[model samples]
Structures are given as C-alpha cells and as structure tokens.
Target: MDKAEKDQQDDSQDKMVLESVSGRRLSYDMKTPFYGDCRDVDDFKKLNRVGEGTYGVVYRVNDTKTGRICALKRIRMEGETDGLPLSSLREIMILKRMRNRNIVNVTDVAVGPQLESIFLVMEYCEQDMGTLMDAVPTPYTPSEVKCLMLQLLEGLNYCHKNYIIHRDLKLSNLLLTREGILKIGKLKFPDAQHQTHGIDLIVLFAADFGLARTLSFPSKPMTPKVVTLWYRAPELLYGDAHYTTAVDMWSVGCIFGELMKHKPLLPGNTEQKEIELIVNLIGSPSDAIWPGYSKLPFAKTLNIPKQEYVRVYMQSKPESFFHHTENAPLLSSFNNLKLEFPRATEHTLSLLSGLLTYNPKARLNVKQALRHPYFIESPRPLDPSLLPTYPEIRNQVSEKEKNRRAHDEERKKRLAHEGNDSIFSADHYKKRRKD
Candidate 1:
C-alpha cells in the first residue's frame, strides 16, 4: 500500500509542475522569446486599422478575454525569411527595457498561428498629434502648446538620460488620449477631463521606437538617412554620420515651430531645398559660429547661400566706432527667427533658437530646454487635464474622405484663380462662345 500510494503522488505532483511552467511561460517572460510561449493572436479581435508605418501595421483591437482596448502592431516580416528584422528586435528590446509615463507601453506580445506573424499589444491612444493638427482649424494656444511640449521633453529627457537616442521624433509619432493627456510614444481620461485642476492627469507618450538607438560611449556612426524627411536634423542632411543626441534636439525645435505655425517650419521637398530652407531661416552656417561646420561631409558641396552682415556706423561716434564696426559683423544676417515667429515671446524665441542652434554642441539638451524660462512665464503651461479636446480625427477620417477633401481644396484653388483672371482672357472660353 505504501509503495503504490507514493508512486501515484509523485506522478501527480510532476504533472502539476509541468502545467504551472506552461502557464507561466504563456503569461509574461522577462527574456521575451518572440516565438512559441506567447498567447495566440486570435485572442484579440481587430476593431480597425489605425495606421501603418515602415516597420509595422497598427490596429485598434479589442482584447476578447478582458474586453480591454489595445493597439496591436503587426511587425513587418515581408522579406524576412531569416528571422525578425533587426529594427523590430531593437524596438522590442528598447521598449521592454524602458518604462515611462510619456513612453508607449508594450504590454504583451501575441503570436499568430504561424511564426512569421507577430504583434505587439500596447495601450490604446485615440489620436496622434499629426492627424489632430491637420483636422483642427486653429493652432494650439501658448499654454496648451507648453503642456504638450513639456510632456514631450520629459519623455525625451528620460530617453536621453538613459543613453537612448530617438532618431525620429515627429508629430505622427506622438500620440494623445481623449482626456487631453499628451503621450510621447513612437505612440488617457475621464470626467476629470472636464475639470481644469488635474494637471497631473494629462500625459504625452513618445511612440514609435523603430528608429531609436541606444547611445554608446564615443558614439558610433549610424545611418544618416534615419529620421523622416521633414523632421530630419541639419547634421543628418549634411551627412554627419557620427551625430549625437543633438539631432533629436533639432527635431524637437522643428516640432516646436510646427506647433506654433500650424504647419511644417521647413517643408522642403528635396534635401537641397531643405538645406536652403534652414539657411534662409537661421542664416548660413560657417566656421566662425559653428566650429567644424566646414568639415561636415556635404558642407563644401552644397551651394549654401552667403549673406554678408554689414555694420552701419552711426557717424556720431567718429573713428573709434568705425574701427569696431569694420571688424564686427552685424547680427541681422544671423537669423530671421523673429520675423518668422513675430508673435512669440522673447523667452519662447530664445528657447527655439537655442534648440535650433547650428552647432549640435550649442543646441539645448532636454534638461536645459525643460528649465527654459518659456515654461515658467505668465500663463504657464496648461495642465494636461485642462487641455482642450478634439475629435478622434485619425480614426474618423477615411481614405475616401481624405480624397474628397483634397478634391475640394483643388476646386477652391481653381475657382480663386479663375476669379482673378480677366473676363475674356481665356482662349478656351472664347472658342466655346464662337462655337
């Protein structure tokens, strides 16, 4: 009786241990093995395709188990016969390691029936800043802009402090919730949404990490063609491979200008045009202001416009003033940032200028930018909870609606052009009348 009972008990305990191991493996793993172990992708039902990017397709999905809403990103495996793409692996690894309120949270990894199809489950955000900006008729107010920018910088600061460089930082990559929280994701909120008191409630998360890279000592060279064309930094456009976190600062500056202007600050269609735009706005770069500027790979090749700064003497000071004037270049040719942002306060323009400084070394880092006076001035940054709300334009606008809007804009332009023409100027109209 003793031998039979002992043998049966041992076998039952072994089965329980195996079952426990299987359950734990399927739940969460610190190592995050991409294959096998994860829950099947079938557990979530796709609500709609939210957006698509270079590395993956995003969908708003409903967790069938908990009835929770989440964003499912299907990693692009299109030519990846060998294994998961290195970019995807990096994104997963970086995201899983970092946890910040302003950063998009990767909750779990779900696997499809086939190994090739994998998805990242993340918290659902209702809107992305890019789409929201386009849909809204008005630009963000100063306080509101401050609220958004503060969260962005906080998240970015976290990334830089942790030695991570977000190679790409742009509006589309910044996500927001219905409650006025700004999230700084590579991707929040409630009846408190109607209140003006909960500044802590609003948040901005930095989303897409596909282009992010961990900074190493004596920073290594990375691909210069990493960030989106509009938000790409000057160093990148100049083909500076051994760049630093300053590239991200330049992007943040561009984003700041976009928020103020309600459009891209330097929306050049070509690389050459982009450089020209930068030169025109901030003035051309030279060794005097930005040391080693001439040494940039493309500096000599690009036909950067040369604007001479001539000092005008007041004649009241006589020869003494003249001597100083002859050698000193005027500040006029340096930058026309004031003309561009005529309504911006002195502190605001100062912050923008600091961030957009030609020399990456001179540019403001996240911490410095956060401490700028623009944030502490009157009508200080609005609390996230008090931030205004807008329609979920990204989710609501369809391809057909977008096309229709484009057609309407085109029609309006055509009508406006015709209205300005002389009554009988058109040959086509004359011919039709003759017929």
Candidate 2:
C-alpha cells in the first residue's frame, strides 16, 4: 500500500509542474518579435534618458557596433494590438528619404526583445535651443543672429523646395551641437499631413518632422491644429485649412523675432489671446490687407473684436512717441515699429515688418526673406565660425528652476513699472513653486 501510493503522488506532482512550465512559455511567446532589418536593440548601450514627448522617449546611447554616441528614441506603442504606429512609420520613411547636413541623420533602427519595442538611432546633438536659451548667460550678437537665421532659412528653403511643410517650428524643437550646429528634433508627422529643415545661434538645421505635412499641388485642405500657439501662423489660428507654405513663413518670422529679442515675441496663453496679441502688434486684418480675411472659418464663427491700430500703439508707447518737434522729414516719417522694438535697426525692422505682416499672402517667403535688405545691410551676418562662443549649457535645469527664473523676471518687470511689491507677487511666487 505505501509504495503504490507514494509513486502515484509523485507522478501527479510532476504532471502539474510540467503544465505550469508550459503555460509560462506560451504566455511569453505571445509577445511580438522584431522581424525588421535591425533585430537587436542590445547592439547599443543606453546612457541616459535625454528627452520624453508625446511620440517617444529619447535616450542618449553609445552604439557598440559603430563606436558612436547617438540618440535612441523608443517609440511608445503600448496600446497598439496591431502593428507599428503609423506616425513612427512615416517618420522612418521620411528620414530614410532625407539626406542633408542641415537635417538630423537617422543612423539605424533597432528593436527590443520583442517587436513591442522600436528605437530610432539618430546622430546626437548636445542640447536643444529651449534648454540653451533658459541656461545661456549671454545674448547672440546681431551678426551671429544673421548667420543662424541664414542657416535656418537655407534648411527650410531646401525642405519647401522639396515640397515638405514643417507644421511645427518652435524654440524647443530646434537643437544645437557643442560646435554650434543646429539640428531639428521631435519630427512627429501628422496623419496624412506631411513636412523641413533648420536652428539657433549655433549653425541651425531643421529637425523634427512629426507634425510635418507634404505640400500638395492644387492645394488640398489640411488641419489647422498644427504649430505651437506662439509660433503658429495667423491663417492657422484663423482656421484656414487651405493654408499654404505661408504658415511656415510666419513661424520663421516668430523665430527671427525671438532671436532678436532673446525671448518669445508672442507668448499667448489662448487662441483668443494669440489673435488679439497679433492684431495689437500688426493691427486688425482686413480684405484690403489680407484679401480674403473675412472668408476664414474663425471669421464666420468667432466674435473678433475690432482692434484699433493707433490705440494699441498708444497703449504700448506715448502718442507723442511718433511725433517729432524737430521735423526732419525722415525722422517724422518713422512709423510705430521703431517705438516697439527700440533696439532694432531700420533694415531689421523692415524685414520684421514684412515677415510679421497681417496678410499671409504678403508675408516674406524664404527666398524673399533671404534677399531682404537686413541681411545685406552694413553689419552683415558673420561666418558661423566667427560667431561668439560660449560655455556649454549648465547641467539641465529642472522645471522648478525654469518657473522660478520666469517669476523672477516678471517680478523685476513689475518692480520697474511700479517701484513697489505688486499685490500678486507673493501669490505668483507660490503658484510658480507649486508648478
């Protein structure tokens, strides 16, 4: 009785163990495996997490195979029960087709243990302009600004000529290297939307094509919900889906202004505020100026307050600012822009005025902006090598540090205006700390 009972118990236990092992193996095998060109992500040694955004998580990695430092962006595809994300597929296709010094180069593609993970291997740039701008202790000289602007325009012009439109262009998306070369970042192409090329004081290259849309002929209507609010074109803001390359031109203009001012030209918090800020600066749009301004979707639906140009000018500066007692005809003829951007040269102002015009049709295209008198004027843009060099950006600042810096600047501006502690200063500081 004892020998037969013991043998039967041992057999049952062995069968149960085998069943558990088989179940574990089946669950593991259910995960998708990479069948693409490069199958092993282990080929690269990940150094650190450099960036994270809507599309993917970026890591600074060393490619063991090539002995090179590169950025590896791991596309977030958790929800997909199907295949690779279409956005990632478009980015891969676009980058593979692009070969330019001004564009960030995709070196290779790698997959993790399962097809669940995908990574894009790109040539690494030291840091992006947003990080640099917040950390750099100095401002760019006019000549240096020109060189950077020229490079950006060159990259963008090349992209446009190739029929790609960069729907999103902002300070944060523009990256720069230690040697002062710019490369665009975060290229997350829009669905059915297509994309450029450009950068900052460092030689600029157009990065990110994620939100980029291909420019179609006989121009089809595309979504207006592209480009960051501050850098977005008026046509986009006004809900003009049939917008053209002029949308990009407006962003270039904003970037140009940012370079000159060393801060965002229009940091509107909302769509209404953005349009209001624009109208306040350039005056309201009209058929006389914009030709088809009234036909926009926003025009038909939104209650756009009629803005008076002279009133806005007076709000920012004294009415007498434009009036001159010494009536030298040229001095009296000077417009309101001189008062707004006191540091800008006449030629620079001329270019800004053209680029920042109310009418998209009237805005300066890349070639037109490149040919503007500002670039050809007396203080020509110096060669990139000759641009002033600065130390590398400080170890990346935390969000708290950025907020504190912003609040400190606001406090200083308020103190300058009122010569006392403003009522909301304490509350504002508290809010910033919380943020």
Candidate 3:
C-alpha cells in the first residue's frame, strides 16, 4: 500500500514540473520569434574562403534557394565559452541597422546545428581594395583615387552621423562590386547616367564592422590598439584613449597617400617605429600644435629631435616678422610634404595635409573633406562606373602565396650571386697554386 501511494505522488510532481516548463517556453516564444525564423547554415553552399580575420572567416557562398551569390562570414568562436563575442554582436547589430549604398548590406544571419556556429550573410563584392591594390600592375590615377575616397568618406559620414565609428578603416575593409547601380531603400538608379564609356559603374562598399562602436557623450576610454599600425593616427600611437572620429580621418589620409604612392604611407614594424615614421613624414607633434600632446602617456618616452628656428612673416595691417620653430627635424622646413609626393597637385596636397593634421581637433571632418577643392579641380573625381575592373586576385592566388613566392625569388637570386663569387675565388686559388 505504501509503495503504490509513493509512486502516484511522484507521477503527480513530474506532471506539474512539465506544465511549468511549457508555460515559460510559451512566454519566451511570444516575446521574440527571432530564433524561430533563423535559417540553417547548411542552406547556403560554400564556394570558397575569401578572407580570414581576428573575428571571423569570410567565404563566398551561393544561396541554394535563390541561386544568388553571397558573402558568408562565420563568426570565430575559438576558446569562447561565454557566448557570441561582443565584437560580433556589435557588428551584427550595427550592420542590421545601417542601410547605405556605400556600406555592405547584411541580408540575413544563418546558424549551424551548434550554438557557436553563426554566420552573417552579406551581399557579395567582386573585389576588396587591398587585394586589388596589390594585384594591379599600376596604381590608381588621381581621378580614380578621388572617386574611391569620395565613396569611402560618404560611408564614414553615414556611420559617424549615426553615432557609430569604424575603428578599423583599412584598404582591406573596403569592398567593391562590379555593379554600377546605386540602390537606396526603395529607389533604384539603374539608368544610363550612372554609366561611363559603356562600362557599368563600380560600387565601393565599407565592409567588416567588427571593431566598430557607437560613440557616447563625454568620451570613454577605449583600446588604442584598434586600427592597423600603418593607418593608425598619431594620437593613438601616443596612447590617447579618449579618441574620436579624428582617428578615422587619419586613416583616410594614410589611404590617400598609399593610393598616390602605390605603397603604405607609414608601414612600420613596431609601434615605436610607427610613431617615428609618422614624425618623419608629418613632422614631430608638440604642445603648440597638438593641445595636451605633452601629457599623453607615450609622449614623454619619445625622443623627438630638435628642429631649427626659421623666420616666419605674417601679413597684417602692419607686416610682422618672427622666428617660428620648424617641427620637422628630418625634413627641410620648406619641403615638409612636397618632397614626398612631388607629383601631387597643390589642392591634393592641401587635402592630404588637412586629413593628416597633427591635432585631432583641427583634422578635417568627412563633410569638410568631401567639399575640398581637390574634388572640384580640373581632374575631377571620375565616376564610380568609370573605375577600371581587375581580376579577383583572391580567387587566383592568396596574398600569403604571393609574398612567399617573392621571398623565394629574392633568396634564389641572392644565393646565385654568392655561388658565382665562390667559383671565382676557387679559380684564383688554383691559379696561385699552379704558379
């Protein structure tokens, strides 16, 4: 009798627990149906790996349902036991909210059977600016560079306006599509006006928002090691934590210089080397030029060389003259930047200087940069459609392979020269012995 009663009580308790669990599940389902609508990663067919970064591995995939090509980015979850990385979450949240022609569009998010296997489905771009720059035989002309810069600035302007900052703005993060049309929310411009010389217009897109963040009032401290070393701003190098969009403007300046020169403007191996490069290129920063510069954490450790004083004339109601100390220790005061880019036009140089200004406060904003005289000059910005197309280098050969080949070729040439020198020395020794 006691055993039968105990078994019946246990059954009643189990039934109550099941009902409670069902009620909670129903409540969550009603609140948000996001998980319910998510598609499986298996739905898209993997084409090839396009890129791999700190946060994700990007692949060119085809949508089996629509037969449309898309870029699939799988979020990297290695050693991540907590959940989705905050950077990935921020990227997904930002991309989903932003809709601009110059910015890459995220179509959907696909998940795998496991909780960690998450992927972002985005519009496929034919080429990234970094690979194209490295693969192309020639550098982009001034007009073409202007066109690309304009699109990049437009995208950054949009992001900044929305209180977002793309901490990492490098050539690699920029995407370009073969299509020329500019499609807004519901409006599409697929007319002849968008074409140039019978070629469809190319569209530039700002992609990979992994390190992006929303700006807050009364600036907060952030990690200074964000932008790539080559494009990092001087302030960031000096350990400025309370940075702003000015950091992005500095990167744009670096990109501008790279486009004109066909190489990195400040390609340094280490942070100290990077700072030295910046100082050499743009002149040393001082408290006079950059307010609070001397107070920066890294400023005191820098060994900035002293420069000579030059006579500066000021034109006013009554002309005034004074000895102004030149800050460029390595460069002549008269040829600070002209010596670097001898072919750059006056307006172009001015724009570059404005962007790469030492002071964050004095740096050109996106709006100001877009309206610079360089864009309005004789060699105006070529239309995006007119930009030349290049073969997808990523498909042909990876960057790593190209670098390895170059290194191997150099080593072979070096070894061959050494071998010839050794042979000559051996012949001389034999002749001496015969004599």
Candidate 4:
C-alpha cells in the first residue's frame, strides 16, 4: 500500500478508539451507583459522635434519603496498607448472617468519595446499658434484672446455636432501645485483650465479638488473650489455648455479681494480679479443682510458687520440715460472692456458682443458665413493656473531646504557673537591686 493510505487508516482507527474511551468514562460518571448500597457516607449527616474505639468511630447520623436517625459506625482504615481491615470485613459478614430481635442490625453500608471510608448504618438505640446504669438514679429491681438477663440469654442462645461466641461481653456493648428492647452492639472481630462504682443495674444482649470465635469440635487453639481483664475467665488467665463457651459464662457470672452489688466482683490491675485476686476470692485451684491446672502454658512459668509452703517443726523427726499446701490457703482465702452480695438469694448464689464454676466442663452453658431456677423461681422475668424507663444519658463530649478539654486545661495551668514564676523573679531582682 502507499505510505499516505497507511497513515490515513491509522488516524481513523486512533480516532475511533479515543471516542470509545470517552463514551465509557461518561457512562461510569453518570451511573454513580451508591458507594456500597443505598448511598455514600456523605449522604448521611453526622449529628454527633456517640462513641469511639480502636476499630471505629460511632456517630448519631441522619439519613437524608430516608430521613431516619441511625447510628453510623465508620470503620477505621487509617494507615491500612493491606486493603480493607479484616475486622471490618468480619463484622459486616457476621452481621449480615445474624438476624434476631435481641441482636443489633446493620441496616446499610456506605463508602466515602475516595473509598477511603466505610460506614456501617445500624439501628439506633437510645443508650447503652452502661450509660443507663450511670445516669439512672433509681436502681433496677431483682425482677427487672431478671428481665434484662433473660433477654441477654436469649440473644446469647441464638449466637451459640449459630456457633458464634461473643468474646467481649460487657455493659457498654449491650445497647438499649427506647422501647426497652436490648440489642447487642459493637460486634468486633477477635483479638488479644469498666468502672461501675455506684452504678445500679442492666442488658440482656451479648455484644462486642471482636475477640469472638466460632465453635469447632476440638476447637483450634486460639490466643488466650481475649475478654477484658475484669470479665476474663480463669482458663484465659491460665493461657489455655483451647476453650469453649464456658469462658463467656464466667464473664456472665461476673456481670451477675456486678448487678447484685453495683460494683465489679474481681477488679485486677495485671494478669498476675488478677489471678491473685481470683485466688483470693475463689481460692486457688489444684489438680482436683482445675483438672489440668498444672498443664497450662503460664502455670509453670508463673513467678509465684505453685503451692504455698509453710514451715513447721516435725516433733517425730525432731527436724524442721516444710508443709506444702497444694492449693491456696483456704483459711486465708474466702469466696466473697455471697458476702459482697448479701441480698442475693440462695437460688441466685446457686446459679452464680454454676456460671462461675472453676471447671470449664461444669460451668453452665447459656441454655442451662437460662433454665436455672434462679430465673424461674420467685419473681419471674418482668414483661419487656414493664421495664423501668430512665432519662436517656447522652455524654456532652466524646472521648476525644474529653481528652482535648483536659489537654487545654493542663496547658492553661502550666501557662499560669509560668507567668507567676516570671513575676516573682522580677520582684526579687528589683528588691535585691534596691538593697
């Protein structure tokens, strides 16, 4: 072919390709489907932030499309180089599968303009159990406590039936709707992991499964670093890799005690200290108590002696010998569950004993706990409609806000002190010169 004909044909092909590219870009721009589902994150107006944590920031938002108030949780993607976080993915996946009255619902999910942000649209609950307990001046009656507990058990039962174990069950995670329905919230993905000094009563839903695991026969060994220190089970403290739902029951027992006393049952500063506190309150475990007690990963490595040694003189031998006690000195140790919660009934104590049983095998599962006489006898679980109503407690500032205010206050105080020091120095210099 001639050079001129070849050049003309090439130009025509290039022009057509450019036109096709332009058409595709325009189509994409016009389509603009919602970032994830119904709308972008910007579609929801953030009214105020409700809570914040390592995984996400929760905001009270208004959906402009539906004009409905909702809780929008923005999953933190900051500094994430490996793409979307596994925590966010697990939460979204789990919430999609779980559908129950007691469980919190993830209504929608949306992303920001740059796809850097992921917001989970959830059903808004007026307050969480922690906030309600803190704000409400009136304490919940035993019947009311039963009602809440039943709801929690119901939710937990559902989870267990589905093979999901909520590893981080706490008051803050149990959200309360205006209608007195308890919906679990803050379903986080598993990892290694409150203050209610005068708080009275609260929830029926288990929340915060960040460290939660699915049940498996001969469950795969997982990190023992789960559950908050206060609500943590002894098996976890002992570094037991293999565990089941019993760990959750132990947490429930702690919560049960808290409801009765309005204070934490076993508050500890460190893992060792926490173990010490548990030993002090429940008596140290022996082979009989915790069958495989010595086999725990941390048991042999513990800084403290496995058994308490007492020095005693042997009259028969006429020599000094040490009497080794297998378990913590029972005389010095006491189970103060009853002492601390004197008002709790015998049935209540029995139930608590089952839930808090040192042996994981003996510990009551959610089903057994729900059927316990403590719940069935005397005052039955109150009707949901009859649950006491309290004024919604809304914190004026988020955690970040509180910290910022504190920083400002400290800065002002430092500036004031520095100013005083400068004036004092000036006055002293003048006096010395005059002299």
Best by lDDT: 1
Which rank order by lDDT, best down to worst?
Answer: 1, 3, 2, 4
What would the per-residue lDDT of candidate 1 be over residues 66-175, giving only the tens digit for each residue? Answer: 89999988766555464443334334534655677887777766765454666778888888898888888798999998999999998889888877777878888888
Worst 10 residues of 4 by lDDT: 195-204
Flag the better candidate by TM-score, 1 or 4.
Answer: 1
TM-score of each predicted structure versus truth: 0.74, 0.71, 0.72, 0.71
Clashing pairs in 3: 201-385
> Each candidate: what lDDT?
0.70, 0.65, 0.66, 0.65
For the record, the alpha-carbon RMSD of candidate 2 to the native fold, in angstroms, is 16.1
Give lDDT for model 1. Answer: 0.70
Runs in model 1 lying further than 4 Å from the true structure: 1-37, 85-93, 187-207, 308-334, 397-435
Candidate no. 3 TM-score: 0.72
> Residue 375: error of model 4 in Å?
1.2
lDDT of 4 by residue, 1-435 (tens): 899997887675444323322222122223211122224677789898888877677889999978999988876555555444333443454565568888787776566544345567888888888777766657678998888888888888887887776777777778888788887667653222211111120011112434555666657666688788988998998899898888888888887776666667778888988887766556667667668988888887765424431222212311111133122112212255556667877667666766766778767788767766677778888988788766556745658988997986676566556665665454454465479
Query: Candidate 2 — which residues are off by over 4 angstroms?
Result: 1-39, 85-91, 189-207, 308-336, 388-435
lDDT by residue for model 2 (264-322), tens:
88899999988877776766777766778888888767556676543111112222322
Candidate 4 residue pairs in clash (backbone atoms < 3 Å): 152-204, 188-210, 189-210, 190-210, 190-211
RMSD of each: 14.7, 16.1, 15.6, 14.6
Give the lowest summed-lDDT range of ten residues in model 1: 188-197
Model 3 error, position 343 (Å): 1.7
Q: What is the lDDT of residue 152 in candidate 3?
A: 86
